[model samples]
Target: MATLLLTGASGLVGSRLLPRLVEAGHTVRALVRGDVTLPAGAAAVHGDLADPGSLRPAVKDVEAVVHLAALFRTTDEDAVWRANLDGTRNLLSAVQAYAPRARFVMTSTGNVYDADATRPARESDPCSPTQAYPASKVAAEALVRESGLTWSVLRLPFVYGEGDGHLASMPGLVSRFGLHPAHTYSVAHHRDVAQVVKMALAGTLDSRVVNVTDDAPITVLEMTALAGSEVEGSAEPLTDPWHGRMDGTLLRELGFSPEVPTVQAAARAGIL
Candidate 1:
């Protein structure tokens, strides 16, 4: 079994991915800030992306690097850059220096894609991200491209399902606006997200940038219907603002069919 280095093994996606990786018999070297209980058959390695030097031994002997640690916040620019961009720069440099041959798979957002096109977004579309999160991710993508190491960038859109941050937050949004989201965007399931992450590390995916999301765009109206709240007359709040549109063609070509559809999975996860 090959050794895989997981950076954010404590996060929402990482928490889920950890068990699967261990069950698959892969030796998972999980990085954590302090003392935290690790699952069976997984090794806990202490490291911090902010401290680039700390990653030396963590990256050593690892066959692959699944870098998922990023500071994501729409309002805080300084914190976002420090966590997303700077951390990425440090980690990429360390990976290049230490495990140059290891495949570096990164979790990027579809927010980096242009929203003006109106059509479903694909991997080749020019990124015109207006928000700070996607904007930094755009820069992060550039770092990976220039790292001179084998890499795969999975651009995910509205990753949801039992997570604290997602459509579950829609009820609060509805209450804030006293209505549903006037604008709708593309989305993807969380467990499916884990599969996409694995695919990036496996290197079987032909496409470098695959849009990880649902087959077709699901509207906020449908989402709010699942929200179990009351809404007024047919007055939509705002125009359909494109946060991130995902074109999952490459995912299909790679034969990726997520077991749980985003909406249904959310309901099962108690989000709905």
Candidate 2:
């Protein structure tokens, strides 16, 4: 087992992933800004990504870094940039200076893909995100790629399950984004997110940007219904059917088979 430094331990994704990393027999040091409770096996190391001075101590001697910290779903665009791009620059600099050999695994979003793609977005597709969140992620991804560290980037889709309430928010998001009911989206369960992170730490996904998603791309109509809500059905022609869909062939080629293969499967298993 390796000594790992995990950022964003109190957030939705990190909160779920931290205990899993510890349960897998790894030593985990969770980096946080203020007083916060962590999973039993993790040691808390107070630090903020915005403060470069606080990062060195947290990263020192770590064998790997799982960077799950990012800002999204906020109206403040500047805050989004600072937290996502500038903060990642700080972490990358600290790791390079303090723990030069640590493997860096950064989680990103599938929204970075362009909306008018002909098919499910691939790793090589050009990222042209117009919104602040995904734009910042694209810039941050550039930093990680150019940081000269052993790095792996996981582009996550609509993460759900484990009562995170992310799936339940689909109805609101559908109305907000003006999405057609027939439009499909790729998704990942929290369990599968941890599974892929373990694989990255094992060096199975070095020097690659991988799309981590489940086996099925679910429709917005089904997602809304599953969320215990309803949306108006649309028979109108969909303009961007593949907008949020991603190609998971790369992950499969890398020997990844999602534990929760589909949202329907998740519902059946009582995990959603």
Candidate 3:
């Protein structure tokens, strides 16, 4: 079993990914900010993503690194940039210095490509990140692409299922805040994301940037309906919700298909 170095193991994706990695016969070395109790058979190393020099202890002697750490979002801009960009830099430099040959599997977001009107964004389309999170991720993706180490970038969309709590409240906000009517964005489930990560590390997926999404796409109204709520008004589809979707063909070729491909099934699985 290769010793897998996993960052953000306590996070939403990483938390779920650890057990699967262990079950697949890979030893997991999880880096955490504090003394985080890990899943059975996982090793914990105390470390910070924004601190590169302090990462030697965490990155050493690992066969591959699955980087999943990042600040999600906030009202503060400066802090957000530093957290996202600096953390990425620190992790890359530390891995380069400590384990250059380690396969770097980065979990990036589809937001790297600006929110689009076109349904089903492909891997070949251009990127224009309007938001800070995606912008920094784009920079990080570029860094990984240039580093020359064996790496794969999975541009994840709005991941759902696996007990995602936020989905319950989004539709309730449509009338509360009067959000501009926009088509619902594409969504990937938590399990599929973890499955593709393992695939990337196992070298089954060849694309550097795989658009990790489910096969079908849904609009905001459809998503709300699936979630058992109403948006209360007409959500003019500013862009083709389908264009924001990924073909999911690449992943399907490798046997990556979510049981719940649409919002209705996802919500039902979540018991909403």
Candidate 4:
């Protein structure tokens, strides 16, 4: 197994990923800003993404670096940009100085693609994100591509599982955004996401952007149902037909099929 350096180790996805990496016999050095319980067989390195100087120790001698740190929920655009874009640059700078030969796995959102996709978005699709979160990620992706390192970018769709409330909050998000219940989204379970990271670390994937999602697409109404809510009336047409759906053909081609193929499967497994 590889010696890995992981950022955002205390966050939802990273917390789940740490244990999986440990179980796989990989030595992981988790970067954290403060005190937290780390998985058994994982070491901790105190650092902040906003502080470049603090990241050196975490990056040193690691065979691969999985960067999962980013600001996903914030009203402040500057905060989002700083955390998503500038923070990535800072980490890359550390990687260049310390572990230049290490493989870099970036965690990016599928929202970076154009909103009005007719079919599921693919890695070759054009990017036209206008919002702060996705826009910042786009910029970060550019930085990673130009960083002179072996890199793989995983463009994730709506991820829900392992006690993450992302699926449960879907109904509220729909209400907040005034979205139609008929809107469908590509989704992936946290276990699948961890597997993707593990594969990236093992050098199974090439250096390219990959749309990572499950085989099936789930509707907003289904998500609401899974969240234990009831909705009434006919559904409205999707303004952006392919806003969330992403083609997982490349992911399957890479030989990593999802364990939980849909939100319903996740619910059945009690992970939602």
> Pick by lDDT: which candidate is best?
2
Candidate 4, run of 10 with poorest lDDT: 229-238
- Model 1: what TM-score? 0.88
lDDT of each prediction vs. the true structure? Answer: 0.76, 0.95, 0.75, 0.88
Q: Against the hidden true structure, what lDDT does model 2 obtain?
A: 0.95
TM-score of each: 0.88, 0.98, 0.88, 0.96
Each candidate structure's count of clashing pairs: 0, 0, 12, 0
lDDT per residue, candidate 1, 14-75, as tens digits? 78788888887789999888999889988998888889989888998688888888777447
RMSD in Å for model 2: 0.9
Per-residue error for 43 in candidate 1, Å, reads 1.9
Q: What is the TM-score ranking, best to worst?
A: 2, 4, 3, 1
Write out the backbone clash pairs for model 1: none
User: Model 1, poorest ten-residue lDDT window?
Assistant: 230-239
Per-residue lDDT over 11-87 for candidate 2, one digit per residue giving the tens place of the 0 to 100 score: 88999999999999999999988888887889999899999999988999999999999998889999999999999
By lDDT: ranked, best first = 2, 4, 1, 3
The residue-by-residue lDDT of candidate 3 on 1-272, one tens digit each, is 67889987988778878888988889899988787888788998888887777799988877898988877657676666777778878888888888888889988887776465354667777888767787888888888888777888888877766666546555865666454345556777777778788889887764467888876666666666656775655635453344355656767777676756766676657633
Number of residue pairs clashing in candidate 4, backbone atoms closer than 3 angstroms, sequence gap of 3 or more or interchain: 0
lDDT, candidate 3, equals 0.75
